[model samples]
Target: MFFSKKKNKWILAAVVIILLLVIAYTGEKRERLTFPEEIVMYLVAPAQDLFTSLGQNIQTFFASISQYREIKEENERLRQKVSRVQEEMVDMEEIRQENRRFRDMLDFKEKQEMELLAAGVVARDPTRWFDTLTLNRGYRHGVEVEMAVITHRGVVGMVSSVSANSSQVLLVTNPRLRISAMSQDSRDPVLGFVEGRTDQREHLRVKMDHMPPEAEIKPGDVIVTSNIGTIFPGGIYVGEVREVDVDMFGLVKYATIEPSVNFNRLEEVFIVTSPVQEEPRQEEHSADGEDVPEES
Candidate 1:
């Protein structure tokens, strides 16, 4: 009870002090309790400084957040741009490799001893089964009928027909195409012709005819052109012997040849021009006639 009484007395004293302060403020005639200018400065200046510092700190925090977001967004954009450029660089490298391969084919054609004409494969036979192609070069390019065409790999075909600016080539795989070929090791010649067979299911197959009975023909033997016909040059690589068979009669032997040039995938070819003979011609005289000297 004594403690409670003391608490009530303290509250009453606080109320009285507050009422007096209110009355003094309202009564203008009463002398106001004034503090010196120096004392006012000491009381209010610290509070103002605290409020100003809080506002400045809040602004700086927000600006820093905004700057971080901008930097993150820019980093993402730059990464995407770099990835796109890398993909384009890969595509350019592929194109460069393809161009190099085409240039190598051109160089091989240039190095050949034969007089050559270059032509691109423009079109293939509509009858997809036919081993034939149309060339961009023709009569206008001095491409003549029956001229042999070859790629860097090996023989491709012979010119079958010609238009003004285009020509048709009968591929080596064509059934009508025949070539005299011989083994590189023995130089023993054989006659081979393309056969349109479905067996062994390959790009091309040649039926070798008139293989001598005594000749030892084997698989993996390289076959090249012989001087039997005027169509292709002698010693031009044609194919390799893949298989051999002797008929029941035992009189004739046959072999299968795999062409060195893939007709189904030919892209470009070279046409060989006829070689000019530089030697002078010789003349013969009758028995009674005097030998006539040829003019210089």
Candidate 2:
């Protein structure tokens, strides 16, 4: 609707008066809020409080994430340290065991009268593990074919083949190996021949055969090398008799021998190079067939 001229002038005058009042109100400071100020604070207070709370929550979330990351790193470091310590303990235990073995071997070597060569077992044929062993010593170490191989415990085997740096030992468990053995009882010595049994290979047993039917050999009898053997030294321990049996016709007797050496755990061995030679004794005689007189 169109306003009359007088009305228009009155409207313009009212707008100008309102502008002057606003300018005066803004310039003057008051002790309490104006109606407009109160209305603006009422509208903005909840939004401002919400933004402040959200910011604090975000800061707390980031802090928690950082702490968790540090804890995870510490745990990882501890786990690695524990693993290294465990590995070191295992290595130390291995060294201790090895040292003990070496000491025992050295003591045994010193007590023997025969020329002994120390050698370590290095390998075995998977198919004939129970029947054969490979030694780290060979011709270069004075090892020779048919040489007797013995450990501190007892007889092991004989050297079958030799190389420049390694030798193959025919274990006492092999059927092809044989040793002349006898019972340890001097009063009733029971002579026999010991050889490995093909049928009893799974049990790692040997057969002491050729014992007379009337022989007094029985269970728990200690079998030892006899003077008849050219390869092995006399008096060397062979094994123990576990069982004795007579033939179907009762012509011969046999005994089951459990070897003194555990072939499965064979690690170190000694090769008999030769028997130590002894100096001949000189005989002293008196010219009168009486005690020799000492010169004063």
Winner by TM-score? 2
lDDT score of residue 218 within candidate 2: 87
| Cα RMSD to the true fold for all candidates | 15.4, 14.9
As for candidate 2, its clashing pairs are: none
TM-score of 1: 0.60
Residue-wise C-alpha lDDT for candidate 2, range 159-202, written one tens digit per residue: 88899999998877776666667899647889777777877443
User: Relative to the unseen true structure, what is the C-alpha lDDT of residue 283 in candidate 1, on a scale of 0 to 100?
Assistant: 37
User: 35-95 in candidate 1: lDDT tens per residue?
Assistant: 6635776888999899899989989999879798897888899999999999999999978
- What TM-score do all the candidates reach, one by one? 0.60, 0.67
Candidate 1 regions off by >4 Å? 1-94, 187-203, 275-296
Highest lDDT against the true fold, candidate: 2
Q: What is the lDDT of candidate 1?
A: 0.70
Per-residue error (Å), model 2, residue 162: 0.8
Provide the overall lDDT of each model, using Cα atoms, as 2-decimal numbers.
0.70, 0.79
Error of 1 at 42 (Å): 43
